[model samples]
Target: MKNRAILIILSLLLFIIVTPSQAQTYQTGSYQTGVGIRMGNTGGISVKHFMDGRHAVEGILSARWGGIGVTGLMEWHKEAFRTEGLNFYYGFGGHLYLGRYQRYRRNYYYESRGAIGIDGILGLEYHLPRAPITGSLDWKPAINLIGRTGYHEGGLALTVRYTF
Candidate 1:
């Protein structure tokens, strides 16, 4: 737990330090960085950064039914219809689930282990041109490839983030 905290902190520091230097390389929709919470079937922390006008990356740390999971994604974005500030994005990523879960049924008990999975996302985002807030609605589907292998379908999220 302690080591995980340190690694998360270090990663955020590196993102903050490295982002600005690469900022001038490309144009962005609204703000270059955004951080906030997401609500859906699961609750999580979300951070997104636009490396350029059409390319972005996102990271999520989620608390779910079985355990905690972390996901990373690389995305491509394009303008949505003729709407200003509205964009649609598609991405592919992966997740790592950690922690153990146990179910008790009278005298019988079952335990489940953590798993690693692949993730795909499709979403619509609106970055308000005059405000520091960005709102998005997205669907993420995941398929477990390790541990207990299966497909997970409930991965919709609504997010409101402060951009800078």
Candidate 2:
């Protein structure tokens, strides 16, 4: 409980720290590729690329609930409230999970018991004009289809990436 509060606070602080004020001028052209770390409901590494200013693809490799998994998303972006480097995005994706579970005091093989799910993401991202960094806050909820069938509405995360 306490740790969760701290995590929320820290995420908010990162958002505040990364937000830019008006009167700041960004470079004429921003980079297309980025790599970063994501922390939240599940912690992991993320890679993203902008095919253009408004369309992008992101990939995530992470561990969730003590299990390793990977996800890929295709997102659409739009400017945020007149902020030059700020944008809001939404996307759809899927995930593959390789996990192990104990049942009735027995250990099961992970390969034989894996989960697959569809994911949806919505987030706000800020690209630092003068630095090679970007910050984002997002909610990524998923519905499990294989192994476990249900809706998981708990996918909120904060990410920071080095854009190049």
Candidate 3:
């Protein structure tokens, strides 16, 4: 009986010492905003600003199809109910395209197009338990509101950022 009581007391003391240390190691930040360059054939500089705790606004300036384009986006983020260290986000936005394209016949086609439409994003982000690095993957779908009439585009991207 005395041995069992000693063992229980030791276990309780160990739990009391370790619990606070584990809780203290979970570090999170707020209102993260950043800008960075994307690497790809259709890549650009992107900026994202977080609003409140679960919403964000984003903008991108990219070159595509020999034209320069700009996009505006809004996103909402939520913590995954059953997962730790995971967040899911979604949102919408618009874009404008400018510049020119060359036809197969060697003719030059100049375009000054503007598109205003909705965007949907589904993504998962993981924040390192006490670290400043965040990693994410997301899919974005956008619909064109101007030239091409009923054109739409969808893409997936990976993101990494350092939180402050």
Candidate 4:
């Protein structure tokens, strides 16, 4: 199942990479919103909405360990190099997570009922020209302030969004 899932994700990435078109994207100030899937250690559905040319907010909803996680973010976008449809973004946000079992790398485990954390995100995004689609690779590191207090770093993800 895991291999099949990875294959599907890779195929989607290839599809996004091959097709290019012209469109006003997030950095160009003409795009309004994007909604898609977030694939990562903690992932589900993701939605991003631009407030202006460079500022945007994103929300993610995911289920894990018999519970749910909700995250919100405020981000800034800037053109990367002279590449059309390519941009770099960074942001900070917060999350509320609920779980039944949490693992530790040191060979221990515990049950975590809930927690709140601050999250930071850095990513590169590409808007497919002529297609209402965009793809991004990101790292979102987070530190829990309430429950299961610690830092998490393996938050790398690939997001494919359909924009309007």
Candidate 4 stretches with Cα past 4 Å from truth are 1-26, 102-109
- lDDT, candidates in the order shown: 0.77, 0.77, 0.61, 0.80
Q: Which candidate achieves the best lDDT against the true structure?
A: 4
Candidate 3 weakest lDDT stretch, 10 residues: 19-28
User: Which candidate do you rate higher for lDDT, 1 or 3?
Assistant: 1
Please, what is the TM-score per model?
A: 0.77, 0.75, 0.65, 0.78
* Deviating ranges (above 4 Å) for candidate 2: 1-29, 103-112
Over 1-164, each residue of candidate 4 has an lDDT whose tens digit, in order, gives 54564455456446544545222453553468999999998689999998878779999998977899999999877777768778877777899988766677567666678889987777899998888999999988777889877777646899999999
Give the C-alpha miss distance for residue 6 in model 4, angstroms. 30
Q: Candidate 2 — worst ten consecutive residues by lDDT sum?
A: 20-29
What is the full ranking by TM-score, best candidate first?
A: 4, 1, 2, 3
User: Tens digits of per-residue lDDT for model 1 on 1-164?
Assistant: 54564355456445543543322333456688999998896459999998878789999999876679899988877667657788877777899888776778689886667889887777899988889999999888777888657676646789889999
Q: Give me candidate 2's TM-score against the actual structure.
A: 0.75
Candidate 2's residue-wise lDDT over 1-164, tens digit each? 54564455457546644665332333213879999999998669999998866678999998865678899998877677777888877777898888764344246533336779887777899988899999999988776789765677656899999989
Give the candidate order by descending lDDT.
Answer: 4, 1, 2, 3
Clash totals in order: 0, 0, 0, 4
